[model samples]
Target chain A: MLNIAVIEDDKYYRKDIAGHLSRFGKVDEGKSLSDAITLFDARKYDIVFIDLNLSGKMEGLDVIKEAVKRKIPPIVITGYTSEKLVSRAYQLGCKHYYNKLDIQNSFEEQMAPFLRSLVYKQEDDIFSNSFVTRNNILIKNIKLVTEQMFLKNNKVFITGEKGVGKTTIAKFIHKFSTGSMDSFIHVDIPTLENNMIEPLLFGYKKGAFAGASDDFKGLIKQADKGTLFLDEISSLPPSLQKKIIKVVEDKQFYPLGSDQLIKSDFRFITSTNENVEGLIESERLRPDFYFMAKDVELIIPPLRERVEDVRPLVDHYINKSGTSLLVSNDSLKLLENYRWHDNVRELKKLIHSFCNCNTEMISLINLPEHVIENTIPSGQSTPLASVYTKGISNFIKKHGLKKLIETIEIESFKEFYEKNHFHYMNTLEELHISRTAGYRIKANIKKLDKERHLVH
Target chain B: MFTDKEKLLHDLNGNIVRLGSIFNILNKIENSKDQEISKNEMNQMLEDAEQTAILLNNDIKTFISINMNN
Candidate 1:
């Protein structure tokens, strides 16, 4: 069963939602903004249904902002519709937003798709052999349709650069659906020998070919009642694509050299790092196969975008090596900033290299010359004032230095305070600011901290 | 071009329907006899409608105040 939470001020609406959703999960209610904050902090619910306009001037946005930082997708329910509110909420990383007017009529029916996606899934799988990540958005996107994939027999198409764990996601879908890693047939299209592709996929009858002594069940048949994942799908031969079309549509096919039609019901998941349009236009990939696999598409972001995962990945590798080694903050910073062209594969390779080092802690000195050269130095930073060179010059040209200085005051204070070890008294004394000035700066810092979702 | 008054009334009506009053309307109709609408369902809908009405009234007050200023 799923754990669900609701944040709505209206008693009647609250009860309606609670009662309706109780069928799927235990309904926990929080009416006010404070309750919402507490609800988020105390227990991590699988899904949160939030009324977009909860009493205090769209306080729902505030709740959503908090939820996003926690990496929980908020299902926004509201009557007061605004493009601005929707855009802002999405910018803050809200995934599902629904209009109350439309949904209320058939609450259960309207939300069945999202609600039925209640398979037991963790955003991270750190405890298992496969790694977990803080990349909740990617995980949630896949999770949002996991139930539908199994229940409705929909195929999943995953697109990501090599080493971004497309196979891992495919396995996650099957594992969570079945609660085990069984009968997951993975065919790496690019790695398979060109001649072996046909015989391996659609197994041949006994004496079908020169070496065929016994009837071999195809990969498709092996994946019956399980998931069949085709990795690097663009590499699949055109001839195979034409032959597999029948299996894709009817879930039945003829084994090579056998007239008997075999029925194999398997969940299909295909992945490619290449652009689909390019593949289609160039005729490398057939459009029919692409469309069939593309019903529920998931795009995984590269490592550089998910900077939060860097330190954990580094730690995992170090711990796995059993060397009791650690990565220095500086080295981790450099690693986080580097453009991972090869994605996680590149990161794992780099981590493996670091494990071979003699030092207890892998620091900047231990990094490969090429790796260090490619990365931005952890200690160096470009001055913020120099950032809008053209715009700033124009602003100063038209307005003056006074307004520009005023604009950078908060930044200046932050820099000064940080330089003084973020100690208010020392920073104030060093800056020679009055007590009132210090108080205002401290207040602003608190405001900034809240805005950054550092404190609930 | 909807007038401010028209939009407000429309929004109010929409909320009223969404508050589960649509079920009540259905129950009143002869064709809706098939639905075994219970007292609990009716009560829940009425309670929700009443609270939303109050909230909507407050918002209308704010909108009227802003319009008066303009």
Candidate 2:
């Protein structure tokens, strides 16, 4: 039975709801908004039936707002059926709006469907397929594709930048594959570089190598009837790549220091940050292997494109790290606007730093000066303009010169100097400046540095 | 502010207790299988399981809401 809370000011209607709902489950009754809040805090209620027309200093809308703030969906039971109130109730996150006049008959009917929808909605909202993290639209898209691939027997090739979530995606595919979960095996090809490929793919007898002490089962044999995720597939040497192709296509490989051939069946999943097509063009990657694995190639997008997902990704990192670091809105805005060149790995490191600082909130002051300083044009020129102005002020404070006298016109010179720090000569060879002005500026900077040092 | 860890632990304990009670009832019914059990007994076992499941579901929902909000 669902634990329910009935919040109504009217004595008769409140009694009626409690009496009716008690038949379904345990019912907690509250006469006022404060009482409702207290009951909600004290107990875990599945559904909250709140009267929108509560008579008192406290309004029912306040209770609804509190519930919404707590991320709990409230059901509004009101005598007032105004369109304004209904729309407002929805805005306040009320999942069900019911007229109290028909509480006896229609209440259960309305609540039945609402509760069912709530369960499904909660599940959908929690585990959304469209959810992106750290602007990594590629990972989100890969997640969806991998889910689809899990149901079918298909070759999936994951490619992305190094330290991108390629390995994570490969593991996700293994975990979610339709095949038995225990059958999935992750094999790092780079680790097999020193060993003979055949022995790694097929089980080796004792003393197969100089130091072979015991017989070993290969990854392909162990991954039979499941997935064998090959990480850093590009690192496989040409000879190993050809052997891998043969194993993938012919389903057979010979063990090292042996002549007998062994057969095994396993689905192949490969990951590489490098461009396999480029490797094939360079004749480093075998054409047969590339063609065999080219059926479902998923190119993971970099993190810069999907800046909107940074907050939740940061939250996820913070949660996983068990850190109580709260990211301030402004600081989060800075993070979201940054061009995360290193993708999720870099963002995770930032979170680690924030956690290590042990600050309650990650403010702009706590962030690395460069991160806060380099706010990319987040499509909002006004904010960037303000930041630029602030940066110029800081620069001016550091450099105590009103303006540098230069050969170029003063107005254009100031703009160029403020923007590019007199680097126009580097960009344009003929853009001349007075040597005396440059010397004067250099002398002023040295003087300012000396003064700063003395003050510190 | 209550930490999410505390709330989750409290909810988990409550669910474990509820599920344990249902399991006990199921165990009792299985033990008494040799003696023809009445329909009412079977119905009670099913009802207990259903109630426990609902309680567990409610606890899970609460835990999720608390964690997400935090």
List the pairs of residues colliding in candidate 1: none
lDDT of 1 by residue, B1-70 (tens): 3456545754664466455634434444435454366789767657766777886787678667867998
Point out the worst 10-residue segment of candidate 1 chain A by lDDT: A378-387
Expressed as tens digits, the lDDT of each residue in A269-369 for candidate 2 is: 88887777788888767788777776688777666556766887888889888977788889888898875656777788889877877878888777865
CAPRI band of model 2?
incorrect
lDDT of 1 by residue, A52-153 (tens): 667635688888877777877788887655566678778877778887766767876689766765433342342245665567786568666565574456
Docking class of 1: incorrect
* Model 1 alpha-carbon miss at residue A33, Å: 48
Worst 10 residues of 2 chain A by lDDT: A403-412
Comparing only chain A of model 2 with the true chain A, what is the TM-score? 0.56
Query: What TM-score should be assigned to candidate 2?
Result: 0.49
